[model samples]
Target: MPDETLVDVWGLAPAVLVIMVGGLALGLVVAAVDRAVVSGEAGRAVVEPLLAGARGLVEQRRTTLAPDRLLWRIGCAAVPTLALLSLAVVPVGGRTLWSTSADLVWFNAMEALLWAAVWLVGWGPNAVHALTGGYRFLAQGLAYELPLMFALITAGLAAGSLRTTDVVAAQEGLWFVVTMPVAFVVFVAGAAAFAFWGPFAAPAAADIAGGVTSELSGVDRLLVDLGRAVFLGAAAAMAVALFLGGDAGPWLPGPLWFLLKTLAVVTALVWAGRRVPVLRPDRTVEVGWMVLVPLTLLQALAVAVLVLNGFYA
Candidate 1:
């Protein structure tokens, strides 16, 4: 094993290695904290997960009849993989691993992969509940995708660039959250859908017998669980970058500030996830098309008008 590698992999740059390990660790810790807070057993809550993981490690993997083994494997692993890739573009202070002009688009696209991943996982299982869970995720994308895009584009339009770093720069003095509260709210809702958290968890809800994941177990199940946490954490990190003025706080280093903001967003999402009522999959489509679409569109147009008049300038 290499002494300097986060995952015993060879040839990763120090920065990339740090971000990879740090991001995963951050997601895990936040998730444990959220679970503890929600269950009213804050003490030893963190340690409980370690024991749970040990149990999962020893559990047997289950299989179903006529399963698409390849797709099932790929889908099970892809969630966290995509999420880590998405996190690469998220700024920790003034630095990012691969900051590009297309970061906003990249972030959106990566999050969008949840649809395919979840569906594949469901379809691969060839079971009724699993397939239904996958279908619910696809339905979720339809509901949240457009509003998510417009909300993100609102930031890009204001900054006049699609770069995540640029969005942060544009928020130096005035965070977009102040001017585009509607967009911010929509962004959070969209993020929740992607994470299948909060009211958007119909796909895997009790009504569906645990839905898409009803068949998953062992390492496969662990990956999906951690991936969801990381996806939510990534969304929260992006919210900090795109709306809360990334790393612009006083009296703290950029990474520390970024961490603080990310934690705040994660806390909010977790709280909302527990408090919000789950929407039926059918109702989700209706609301996404009828309500969120028009609202986010209007928000985008309003942002366009403001940008055209040099409002943020």
Candidate 2:
């Protein structure tokens, strides 16, 4: 019996490995493909400018535009780096690479701090365009951030735990999206705006003819573009994990379900990028604050009432 059990365990190990590896590979590929598909006049208009700025920084003469050179450099590099680090704690599957109690709240807080870093980067550059971009980013950030937080809080309330894994487990029978459809939509819209994609691309728009990244060049620009793509992927993954019931499904496996859901969300963002015209900065900020924020908060309150009354149970 011992020998038979050992053999069965060995057989299952490979399958387990395949599922984990396949899920990761799928997420990366989908994100990359999404980026590639959108890399054109419409898309490249945003990316290419940043690349140009990075290249300019490297090849052109270095001019000290600001009094505090060190501060500027640090601001430019730190925001994206911090954003990547926060992603580490987010649970990808059965376990996160590093997780602690209440990790979900920590993750959200760290992720939100990224905007501050980005703002600093723009301000440190001391260029007209960069400053304008930074202010625009701040305006948009103010508008969407509250709604995003409410969405996350609603998920936590539903799960009754601040751990992402617990949240996923709580959705055994039905996804949170079904129970909180309005919150899901609100969260997605807020995330897209926060990430500066689609209609909210105003802060980095080519029509603003280069907003915050207008001054970046060479490797710095590359880093910014890469960071944006990675952020896009991460945000989509979060939405999948939170609302879609992270890896919950039948026959295929949990991780595959996770990847499929993430891909679908990322694809939608890319499609929206292509279909929607970039919004004016003023209009974008106005809509986000005046409309989406209150709507999301109300949705959260409804969700709280429903879950508390055991309607979702």
Candidate 3:
């Protein structure tokens, strides 16, 4: 791996292709894992997601009366767009598509934008169920977003830089997960919440007729679901970079090790998410503010203290 940070060796076009194709592929993997976990049928897991995508491609799109066509379309498109965009700063093969001094902030910004995009999806349809879902997502975002930020900041604080590569490099000797496990847990949980996935899926829960997805069908539905899976995979990869020590295994090459770790994280997320019952948005918000906010803050403070003592030095 190169020692220099933010190597732009792969130009813009290639980077975009990598992020697009790689993200979609990872999203499929997430779907498969989730299916296997829930159905206890490994074979079905392999076939279901592909079949679902094909069906989505061929199915007719459903539309509600009095829909805001423009916002609905934009919101649908933005879900996957933002997911790929967020990956620009994530290091792969010891390099990122694009790197900034505040790579962590860049990632966080994309997630924040996703919060709005989801609300738009819920609001665009002009249906009571969809609008309710949108509001639910908004409420959910209020609860989880801050702790997520603190978790990201804790990694940056330990690295003494906001760059993703720097965070990985800082973990050369000790993975941040060892000392900042709370941040790791919160970060992954936040990712699941932001994606409206698993236990944090109140925004799209079935009791409200699929919530934000109530008014969507065909490709629109496909896009939102695809975006959620990809975002979860991206978060797992980012978690690897931030806490598990990006590509730091001994014998295998860096990229392969990174792939392996990412797969493990994805599997763990899906397996665990399946077992926990879906949480109500109101209760989730309460926990986020009352329990998670303080826990992540203390996690950040502890990392800061460790950094001051040159524990990372």
| TM-score for each predicted model, relative to the true structure | 0.93, 0.81, 0.97
Residue 81, model 3, lDDT: 89
Show where candidate 1 strays beyond 4 Å.
Answer: 1-12
Summarize candidate 3's per-residue lDDT along 1-313 as a digit string, tens digits: 3344333566667767877899888899999999899889897897899898888899999888989989998999899889988877888777887777789999999999998899889999999889899999999999999999999999999999998988999999999999999999999999999999999999899899999999898999899998998899899999999999999999999989999999999999998898888899999999999999999999999999999999998
Model 2: residue 290 alpha-carbon error in angstroms? 2.7
Candidate with best TM-score: 3
Clashing pairs in 2: 53-216, 53-217, 53-218, 54-216, 54-217, 54-218, 55-217, 55-218, 206-209
Candidate 3 to truth, TM: 0.97
Lowest summed lDDT across 10 adjacent residues in model 3 is found at 1-10
The reply for model 3, stretches above 4 Å from the true place, is 1-7
Clashes of each: 0, 9, 0
Question: What value does the lDDT take at residue 52 in candidate 2?
Answer: 47
lDDT (Cα) of model 1: 0.82
lDDT of 2 by residue, 87-180 (tens): 5444555554445557567767766776876676577767777778878888888777877788888888888777777777788888999888
* Ranked by TM-score, top first: 3, 1, 2
Q: Considering TM-score, which of the candidate structures 1 and 2 is the better prediction for this target?
A: 1
Q: Of the candidates numbered 2 and 3, which has the greater TM-score value?
A: 3
